[model samples]
Target chain A: MKHSKISNLAFTGLLAAMALVVFVLEAQLPPLTPIPGIKLGLANIFTLFALYFIGPMWALTLLIVRVTLGSVFSGQMSVFLYSMAGGLLSYLIMRLLYIRMKEDRIFVVSVFGAMAHNIGQILTGVLLMQTPALFYYLPVLLISGIITGLFTGLAAQFSIKALKKSPISDSP
Target chain B: MTGRNEHSLSALQWILIFAGLILLLLTVRFFFDLSDGNRERALILLDGKTVRTLDLSEDQTFVLDTGYGTNTIQVTDGCVSVTDADCPDRVCTAHGPLTDNSMPIICLPHHLVIRFEPGHGDVDIIAE
Candidate 1:
């Protein structure tokens, strides 16, 4: 039993590390233009996978760890507070929706999560900057969220299928 | 059955939300009467440096010298846009004129950022 718990913890840590790698990789990509606020949001796949497969608390832990480590690695400690605000809100929203709404549709969840994430981030930006002008970009960001969320959702669905097929988890 | 019902409802909910957003957007686009209001402005930075302040009043055009070439920004009637650019992506130009509140005209290769500023002269946040 103790070994099982230790392995779970280790797995969670590994997932968080994987998330950080995704974040860094996404950051390194040439930012898409035409839409100023758009991003690949690569780390969200891990978060969603953890949410459904492992559990909400583990997902939350992975999210917090990933965000913190990603911030540290990026050397943008100044935006740490904003990212925290965004991350917390996103985690809560995903939890609420997952519990209250019974949708196995990862696509919808991804869209909702992405939208909520943008709102949280923009709100944090407003709070940090002390400028309501930041609200003006909310709509654009919302639209971008839907697009990226759909992409990540599809990726998660495939990953989940692949994981299910793996013989390593044959313990019924 | 419960899962199916919930999935359908959630889809409908998202659609309604997006519809409401579009309605709000159309209203803001057509009815607000921004013709005579105060024009917002943004600072354009290039090459990791501040280059100039741009007025989004449809009355000014500014040319920027990106390392690779040149780009032109035109502002008119409460909107700002990249009229021309030399980047291969031309994404900045494709963004067309920007009238939204917080976003700016950005050209990444040039390391340029354009974001809106409130007229009240508040300075609490710096762009990241």
Candidate 2:
């Protein structure tokens, strides 16, 4: 796994930096849809890349670092709870299913994890807002989750394959 | 671990699973939208509690100061909308009007949510 001069911890930090950069940059873009809580989630690429290429622990670390910094930089501290809930739920689901499926099927893991992420956010919103009317966004979120998950998943899959060509991989 | 299980499904199988899930969600959405648009009153909530009730029949506009932010809500033509707001995104202001029970007009920054109480919920005898 040490194909490069970078240490394991340093490499994890590098991935976290990349994830944070993407997260902040993506926030600059206006909402793609009028529906709230919907975004491309493009920053997930680096985290997913870490999950498949580095390790689950490193991936979790990257996700946490990215989301925390992302909220601070975006100047929207209110969304911090929703982001944490979505990020953790997605990571757990991805970690669970990634091992059961083939390595090439990263898209599947991404899709399911993305959906779980949406559900987690909406649940938090409902609880915090104390209104069941928020459930109305469930279907919209699910649909967006699948589409964005496939996009991020495919990007990560390609990056993983490209990195693997030089014999670089990690264990959970 | 290579992670190849006997029960591991192929790409096609995963697609089928996704399709089934999407179909189910669509059905749920259909039912949610099926509620008749006869709602006569809407609740203006701030931080999970109702602050005021608006009669959709009598069009009116008022400024709601939630301390966190402010929103100018307008009720017109049996619909309610946030006409203006000091929130960062102004998503609520842009939400136009909410006439049905499909989805509430939400202002995350202001912690404001305007939802229509369905016809079956109650009879607005006082409004009449």
Candidate 3:
């Protein structure tokens, strides 16, 4: 039992580091669209994997750590609030959907999760700017979220399938 | 295992539903943008307060100092735009121009927002 616990901690720590690296690297790229709150969200691939393979708690921790560290490393501390809002909302929605659906349906969960993340960020924008005009961007964001979510979700799904088939066993 | 297969079917169904919903949303948004008439007035707000209101018909250029940063706004021929900004993101500047009220040009770092208001009556959307 102790050995399993240690392995779990080590695994989660590794995943968190990998997620942070991806987040930082993605941030370095030019904005895909002039519109804010739209991105590839590649780091979420790891979060989805951790959510299904490790557990919800570890996944949430990994998300929080990655967002916090990513913002700090990127030198855009001002965006940390928006990142936190989006990351936490995505994690919660993913967890809720995962509980209701089968493990094989993680891609769907990721789609909804990405939508929730966009909603959360839009809400933050509204709260910060105190304007409903931001809602105009909702449709554009929703479409982007779906497309990007599908990409990351499929990536995660395939990675998990391959990992399961690998010789090294995943930590429970 | 049976539960897994059944859930997979439902997941596929959900994905289809979401895809349709997204398509519908995009359609609605596109129509809404097309139907929106040209706006004549632009309201500039800094930190939730009305800093200036400009007539889009008039051609003018001005520099706004928000204390945190500066933005160069230009109004010409029924359009308004941020030509330059000191904010690191430059998103507002990159946004180019505003011919309608669909999306406000926002510089979050500077707490600056430039939105097109249809007329003077509903300009105070954000209550101080």
Candidate 4:
């Protein structure tokens, strides 16, 4: 039991690091759309995989660590609040979906997770700016979230399947 | 796998349902937004306060200094846009122009927003 616990912690740390790397790398790319809330959200792929294979607790920890570290690395303290709001909401939605659905339906979990993330960020924006004008972007954000979510979700699903065939799959 | 039997719809079905719902919502919003008519005035707010209001029918260019940074706004042929900005993202500047009230160009770093004031009237409604 102790050995498994140690492996679990190590694996969680690895996933967090991978997620942070992906987050920062994706940030370096030019914005896909001029709209603020839209992006590829590639880092979510790691969180989705960890949530499915590792467990909810580890997945949540990895998400928190990755968002915090990614913000620090990006040198944008203001963005940290937005990331926290979006990341936590996304994690919660994915957790709720995971409990009710089969593992094969991870992509569905990811879609709703992405939508929840966008809603959380927009809410944060409304609060910070003290304006309702942000809601004008909601429809566009919803469409973007669905498209990006599908991409990230499919990527996560294939990655999970590939990892299942590897020897280290037994560790988690 | 036993849990799967309890759910009537598959994942693909759920995705389709959501996609269709969102598309329908978008279509409805687009049509409603179009019926609002062309906005003749644009309001520039800094820190949730009205800093400037421009008549969209006029062709003019001006710079707004919001203490945090500067943004150059241009009004041409019933359209308004941020031609340039010193903010890190330049998202507002890149937003091109606002011919409709569908979306406001926002610069988070400077807490500046350019939005069209709907309805033709001298009474300006400050969005809260």
Candidate 5:
């Protein structure tokens, strides 16, 4: 079945917009932990969606747009550096696994991506703060990464399944 | 398609994988936890550079001007904390005094961090 209805550009734009909205909204919540750089990362769902159903380039584009605009809208410009570091590392991990990932296995990608994201953020913190003590947060951040990644991964997996049956499934 | 199913780990396998990783990380954290001694000296850092070091043995207050903002660091007895900060959230001040060298008190907007300098502290004989 031919699944091309929405143009690729329009669909990518829509996904990018959705990712930005989620990113900014998530920032509003009081931090779940005093230990910085731990969050549910719901915005990653759209990046995963764009990558698998759309294309890698579109996924990258969606991620960049979301991080840039999300920081602006959230009124925390310092977050841009940390988010970019985490987002790029996360994207790299998932994209590397994309070819090997089956429809049922996108969650695995999300899980790994989320873990990488945390590592990237913590590393950035250590470098910026010039404090090696920040390494103490590693275990806490990694544990949060696994649990939250599983949640977001499953969410993206289910969303991908739904999109597979939609008009934009084969946009790539 | 050739590589897809070949690389996918079953749900049970992924669960075990995450479980093992979590266990491994927890163990590392446990070891790190034991390594930290009591807070003996407090150091103020701005933009990753050390600006001042205060001895906790001498209970005193120092107002730091980071150029970005100000953080009033207080050392009372063996405990240390940020009593006040010019940053909007002032979360550093709310962090209260730290009991040990576990985590640093930070002011995000001002790019300030106050933490204990390790090794100068006496060993925790109870843990040993």
Candidate 6:
């Protein structure tokens, strides 16, 4: 049991590193549209995977570190607050739903998480800009969130299934 | 948790939720449609700074001083577009026009934002 625990921790660390790399790589991609808030949200696939395999606590740690480091490396430190708020809220919501909902219905949690992140970010934008006009963008962001979350959640599902049969699956 | 059924909602419920969302979107689009020569207002932001407030009712074109150079954006036919920019991406140009209230014309390097605001006569969605 002690050996198994060590291996699990190591595996979690590796997954965290993988998530960080994906987050960094995704930062280089341009937004799909010139809109300030539109993007592919490619890194979310890793977060969903981590949430499924390593569990919520591990996933939450990965999110915090990734956002903090990513913002620093990108020289967008000012955005750290928004990213933290969105990341934490998304992670918490995902965790609750994952714990409470049926396995087949897990994707719904992911969808809600994505929407929550967009809402959280938009709220931050409104506060920063000191304008209520930003609320108009809420609908668009929520729609984008639903689509992106579905794609990322599907990716996570497939990845988890594949990983279960791989050599790494024996770690725990 | 065994045989507690595990599942909360049936497949039918999921379908209903998606259908409802679609219906809401269509209704919003139908009511909020904006076209040529409509009077509106837009707020311009450069790197989080509110540089200017534009009135679409009167101003057809204006030059924004980006501290680097002057960039020109024009509002015509109930749409806003970047006619000229010193920025390298020229993304603002590609954004074309703003018809949707949710979509904004953004130039990241310049931190410029151009988003549509419905006229005062139009109903505010938030108020409802």
Q: Per-prediction DockQ scores?
A: 0.20, 0.42, 0.49, 0.50, 0.42, 0.29
**Candidate 3 total steric clashes:** 0
Q: Per-residue error at A171 for model 3, in Å?
A: 7.5
- Candidate 5 residue lDDT tens string, A1-172: 2335456668889988888888888887865665567788999999988888778888898899889988889888876788999999999999998877777888889889999999998888878876666667778788989999988989988987886688655544
Chain A, model 4: TM: 0.94
Candidate 2 residue lDDT tens string, B1-128? 24366667777888788888888988987777776345788888887788998888998989999978789999888888988888666767666788555567888767788887655432222223
> What is the lDDT for B123 in model 5?
34
Chain B TM for prediction 6: 0.56
lDDT tens readout by residue for model 1, B1-128? 26435435555576677567756755653432232223477666554355676666548887878665688988788777888876644557877776543445655444455655433332223333
Task: Name the best candidate (by lDDT).
Answer: 2
TM-score of chain A of 6: 0.89
Candidate 2 runs further than 4 Å off: A2-6, A166-172, B1-3, B36-38, B121-128
- What value does the lDDT take at residue A151 in candidate 5? 86
Better of 3 and 4 by DockQ: 4
Give residue A28's lDDT in candidate 6 (0 to 100).
Answer: 64
Considering only N, C-alpha and C atoms within 3 Å, which residue pairs clash in candidate 6?
B36-B77
What C-alpha lDDT, on a 0 to 100 scale, does residue A22 get in candidate 2? 83
- Write candidate 1's Cα lDDT for A2-90 as tens digits: 22656667777888988998887766666475654467777989888888767788889898998899878866464466567777887
Top-TM-score candidate index: 4
TM-score of model number 2:
0.89
Cα lDDT tens digits, model 6, A1-172, are: 1236566567667766777677767666654666555566666777777777766766777788778877777665656777787788888788888876544555677778888888888787776655555565676677777777767777787788777779867644
Which 10 residues in a row give candidate 1 chain A its minimum summed lDDT? Answer: A127-136
- 1 or 5, greater by DockQ: 5
Q: Arrange candidates by TM-score, highest first: which order?
A: 4, 3, 2, 5, 6, 1
Error of 6 at B34 (Å): 5.7
